[model samples]
Each structure stands twice: as C-alpha cells, then as structure tokens.
Target: MKSTVEQLSPTRVRLSVEVPFDELEPDFDRAYKQLAQQINIPGFRRGKAPAKLIEARVGRDAVLSQVVNDALPGKYSEAVTEGGVKALGQPEIDVTKLEYGETFEFTAEVDVRPEIALPAYGDVAVTVDALTVTDEDVEEQLKGLRERFGTLKGVERAVENGDFVTIDLSATVNGEDVEDAKTTGLSHEVGNGQLIDGLDEALVGVKSGETKEFTTTLLAGADAGQEAVVSVTVGSVKERELPEVDDEFAQLASEFDTVDELKADLRERVEQSKKMNQASEIRDNVLEKLLELTEIPVPEKVVQAQADEQIHEVVHQLNHDDDLLAKALEAQGTTREEFESQARESAEKQVRVQLLLDAIADAEDVSVDQGELQEHILFQAQRYGMNPGEFIQQVQQANQLPSLFQEVRRGKGLANVVLEAEVTDSDGNAVDTKAIFEPEGDEADDAEADAAAESDADAESK
Candidate 1:
C-alpha cells in the first residue's frame, strides 16, 4: 500500500492511494467467508463452502465487489495515517481504479486543520473592567436580603408598583374566548412585568375587586401574534413589610448577630461577585485579542454544520412550527433572514475559536488526564441534570468521548493563554487573576473527590 497527499487548499487535502492485489488477500478472505455464510452450495455445508466454489457460484464480479467494499475503510485509514492527514469530517472517497489481478487506486478529499501561525501568548494583552464594590452595591444586596425576609400583609388601597396582587385573568381573540389564556388566583408582582404586555399598566392604580381591560398581541400559544383583549381582576392587594435594619433583623435574616456584620458580609460577597465578573471579562477580552492576532482559516463545512445545528435547535424548541418561529422573531424585532445571518456569523466565529484553541493545545502539549476528564463529565452531567452513570453511557453510545476530551483540552489551552497573557483592569492596575482562576486548597480537594466519585460511578455502570 502507498499513499500521497495533494494540498487542495490550506484547510483541505486529497489523498491518492494505490494498493497492489497481493495486499488485499486478508480483505478478500474475510469477504469470501462472509459470503460463504450467506450463500448456499449444493454439496458444501452452510458457511463451509470453499472461497473458489462460492466465487464460482456468485460470479467473480460479486466477490470482487464485496472485497472492495470491505477494504475501502481500512485502506483509507491507512492512507490517512501514512500521509499524516488530520481529517476533520468524513472523506469523499472516489475509487479510480480496481482490477481483479492488478492494483487498486482511490482518492479521498477531506477537510483538515490548517497550519496556523500563532502569536506569542506572553505578548497578548487585554483590559477588563476594574473590580469595584461600592456602597450602592452593598445596599442593593442588603435590599435583596430584606426583601427575602419581608412579610406580605393585606393592604386596603389601590394596587401600586412593588406590590403583590392575586388576580383573575381572561383573554379573548376577535371576541372569541381563549381557553388557554384564562386563569384565576394567579399571584404576580405589579412591577415584575413577567406576565403579558400591558398587564402591569392595567394592574397599576386598580383597586381591589376592580377589573381592567387591555389589548396586546399574544406572544405564544395557538393565538400567537394575534391581538387579544385581556381582562384582569384584582382579587387582593398586599404590600411587603420589610423588617427594620437592626440587630434583631440581622439575626433573623442571616447568621450574623449584628446588622453591621451582615452589611460587611454582603459587601464581601459583592466584592467577590465583582471579581468573578472581572475574570469573565478578562477571558472574553483575551480570546478576542487572540483571535485578532491569529489568522485561522475556518472550514466552510464545519461552519455550516455548526450553523445548521443552531437552526435545528431553534426549530426544535419552536416545535418545528414555522409560524411560531416567525412570531418569535417578530417579537424580538428581527426577521428570519436576520436570524440566519446572525447564526452564520456566530457559527463562523465559533469554528475559528475551536480551531485556534486546538492549535494552542497542540503547541502547549495540553493533555486531559482521567481525573480531569471525569471532573468535566461530572460537571456536564450536573448541568444537564442527568445521573453520572446515565450520562456516561449516553456519551459512550454516541461516540462523543473524543469530542468531550477535545473540549476539556481546549479549555485548558485557553486557561494557559489567560495565565500567560497580560490582563489589567480598566484603571490601568494589574488585576490579580490568579485569585480568581486558581482554586484554593479546599476547593481543589472537593473537586478531586467529585472526580473520583464520577469515575467510580462510570466503572460501576460499565
């Protein structure tokens, strides 16, 4: 067997392979055995017929066809290995020559990873928003905590914003009642705007036992995109009475015994959350900078696949109803064309990022150990709300373990880039990225334990 490569483009190649007849003996034998089990012979027992006898019965053409079909995959793989081709997707195979007693030749065209000239990781620089916690931030957190501990009490007054109310809602489309849009005793916050449009405005200033009618276009259901007259009856109005900001309130709301202590804890939490946001900003900016510095040739097929997948998911979520999809786009102030264009652009960027990160992983020799892979599997399982054992089985069945491994490797590669890059805050001060990226001792131990448990679960399932 011999193979040579032709570079059709930076991101694609064609492999030309030729295999002599002598090299296909094993394939021929396997094909003959398979055929012998399926074809009957007058004198020989089932599956016991000789290859020559089977060939004579089935004709030489039939035997050659079976052998060729059985030999292509292995031959293609061998050619790919020998040529050091990093094939992306399936190859387009073309059999150029095939003769019984002569040579077999074929050509395969495939997408491949292009050779990328990467910028120095150390030279990459990005600026992120400075981590700042102000009195307003602490006050906001305190307000949230207070709201959580507040008690709702009946108020004999007109409905107001920030008040909770129980209401009965009914809707009609073109003077016909919409059964699915009618409900009673639904509790809603007046200012939340969680229900239909114009609902908040209708509820505001309405007294108890008062009903207000408003017209708005329905965004979902069978009557989607149709104008509906909705009538809301306020059953009761209530206000949240917040506990005073005192030591007694602090003890009731939190573990802290003093209000001052609670405020301090809330401030610390706000600071920590801001730092997390800063780390995220740094990651995004660093990636953007890397993309700006590197030249990654996106494979068209890969980008198309990604875009198709996104569109498929959107359609699936919309129950494959084109009308519903259109209504959704209209509600978002976009059209189908705009959505597709955005999807394509997003897909191209995503493909470029994947390719760039893969190159970085290779350059850094980034590897995912069993523990790290298990940890990632566990995280994904939790995210998707699946049992670890079940998730492992599903991934294994789908043959997605390699993809998962690549994801982890790419993540590590990005982390390496972030570690090496120079990241500073908007105020021109160097940010302490290590504090956000590096796990502390306890967290590391917990992560290891989770990984071990995930591995054990997977082994049990197997």
Candidate 2:
C-alpha cells in the first residue's frame, strides 16, 4: 500500500491511497464469512460456505463492495498515519478504482490542523484590577452575613421594596384562563423581580389583602410566549429585621466571638475574592494578547459545525419549534439573524482559542497525568450533578475522553502562559499570579481526595 498527501490549503489536505489486491486478503475473508452467515446454500451449514460459492451466489462485485466498505476506515487511518496528516474532522472519501485483481484506490479530503508560529510567553503582558479591600467592602460583606441571619417580622403597612410578601397568582391569556399559571401562597420579595414582568412594580405600595393586576408574557407552559393579564393577591406583608452588628451578633453569625474579629475576617475574604477576579482577568487578557499577536487559521467547517451545534441547543430548548425560537429571540431584543451571527462569532473564537492553546501545549510538551485527569473528571461530574461513576460511563460510551483530555491539556497550556506572562495590577504593581493559578495546600489535598474517589468511581462503574 502507498499513500501520498497533497496540501489543498493551510487548513485542509487531500490524501490519495493505492493498495494491491494481495493486501486485501483479510478484508475479503471477513466479508465472505459475514456474507455466508446471511445467505442460505444447500448442503452447507450457516457460515460454512466457501468464498467461491458465496461469490457465485452474491456476485463478485457484491463481495468486493463489502470488502471495500469494511476496510476503508483502517486503510484511511493507515494513510493518515503514514502521511503525517493532523486531521481535524471526518474525511470525504471517493473510491477511484477497484479492479478484479490489480488495485483499489481512493482519495480523502479532510480538514487539517494548521501550523502555528507561537510567540514568546515572557513577552506577553496584561493589566488587571488591583486586589483592594476597603472599609466599604468589608462592611458590604458583613451586611450580607447579617441578612442571612435576619428574621422576618409581620408588618402593618403597604408592601415596600425589599419586603417579603405572600401572594396568590392567577393569569389569563387572550381572555382564556391559563391553569398552569395559577398558584396560591407564593412568597416573593417586592423588588426582586424574579416572577414576572411588571410584578415588582405592581407589588410595590400594595397592602395586605390587596389584589393588583399586571400584564406579562407567559414564558412557559401551553400558553408560552403569549401576553397574559396576571392578578396577584397579597396575602401578607413582612419586613426583614436585621440584628445590630455587635459582639453578640458576631457570635451568632460566625465562629468569631467579637465583631472586630469578624470584620477583619470579612476584609480578608473580600480581598481573596478580588484576587480571584484579578487572576481571571489576567488569564483572559493574556489569551487575548496572544490571539492578537498570532495568526492562526481555523478550519471553517469546524467553526460552522460548532455554530450549528450552538443554534441546535437553543432550538432544542424551545422544543425544536422554530416559531418558539423566534419568539424567544424577540423577547431578548434580538433577531434570528443577529443571534446566528453572534453564535458564529463565538464559535470561531472558541475554535481559535482551542487550536492556539493546543499548539502551545505541544510546544511546551505539556502532559496530563492520571491524577489530574481524574480530578477533572470528578469536577465535571459534580458540575453535571452526576456521580463520578455514571459520568465516566457516559463519557466512555460517547467516546468523549479524548475531547476531555484535550480540554485539560489546553488549560494547563494556558496556565503555563499565565505563569510566564507579566501581569500587573491597574495600580502598576506586579501581581504574584502563581498564588492564584497554582495549587496550594487545600487544592493539593483536594487532588488526593479526587484520586481516591476516582478509584471508588471506577469500582462502581465496573
């Protein structure tokens, strides 16, 4: 067998392969056996017929067709390996020749990964927000903590913003009652704006036992996407009573015994949170800088496929109804054309990032150990609300391990870039990014636990 590759473009290639008849013996044998089991020949048991007789019964062309179909994948893979083609997606193959005893030939056109010229990571620099925690920040954190411990007390006044109210709701779409939208005794905050449009406005200044009517579009149910007149009957109104920020309150809300100690801890927590945000900004800006500096040609097919997938997910959520999807876009103040354009842009950016990071991983010779892979698996399982065992099984069944492995490799590659790049706060102070990106004591312990859980998950799956 011989294969030669022709570069069609920077991101695509065509491979032509030729194989002599002698190399097809194994494929012919398997095809004959499979065909024998499907056909009935007199005086012969099932799958016991000779190749000559099977060929005579089904025609030689039929046998050769089956052999070619069975052998194409292996032959294509071998040609790809021999030609050193970094194929991205499935190939379009065309059989050119299939002689009786001479040769079989075919050509495959596929998208290929483009060669990348990587820039020096040390030369890349980005600026992020400074990690600053002020008195106002600490007080905001303390206020949130106090709210968590706040008590609700019955109030004898009109419902106000931030007040909790128990209300019964009924709705009608086009003068017809929407049964699915009717509910009794639902608790909602006056200004939360979580339930429906115009609800918060109508609830404000309403007293207990008062009923207010408002118009809102029903987002779900049989009458979804239709404007409905909703009636909200306020059953009771209550105000949240927050305790004073004193030493006694500190003991009740946290392990700290004094208000001063609690405020100090809150300040530290706020600073830590800001550090995380700064780290994320650094990572994103570094990637953006690299993308701007480099020229990476992405496969148009892969980008289109990803865009189609994004659109499919949105359509799927709308129950595959095109009208519902259009309505949803309208509700969001966007057109289908605009949404598609955004999807394509997002998809192209994602593909470019993945390809660029993959190139970086290759250049750095980054490798993912079993523990790291297992840790990622555990994290993804928790994200999807699945046990590790079930998640692993689903991943294996779908042949998605390679994709997950690539994701981890890209992450590590980006981390390497972030480590080498110069990152500074907006105040021009050099930031110690390693403290945010690198695993610390707690993270290391979490990795160990993830490994143990992976062992358990493997056992459960088996």
* Alpha-carbon RMSD, each predicted model: 4.9, 4.8
- What are the lDDT scores of the predictions, listed in order? 0.85, 0.85
Candidate 1: residue 47 lDDT (0-100) = 91
Candidate 1, position 74, lDDT: 92
Instruction: List residue ranges in candidate 2 displaced over 4 A.
Output: 439-462
Give RMSD (Å) of candidate 2 vs. truth.
4.8
Query: What TM value does model 2 have?
Result: 0.92
At residue 279, candidate 2 shows an lDDT of 60
> Candidate 2 on 109-223: residue-level lDDT in tens?
9999899999999999898888888999998998899899999999999989999999999999889999988899999988877888899999998999999999987777666
Residue 33 of model 1, lDDT score: 87
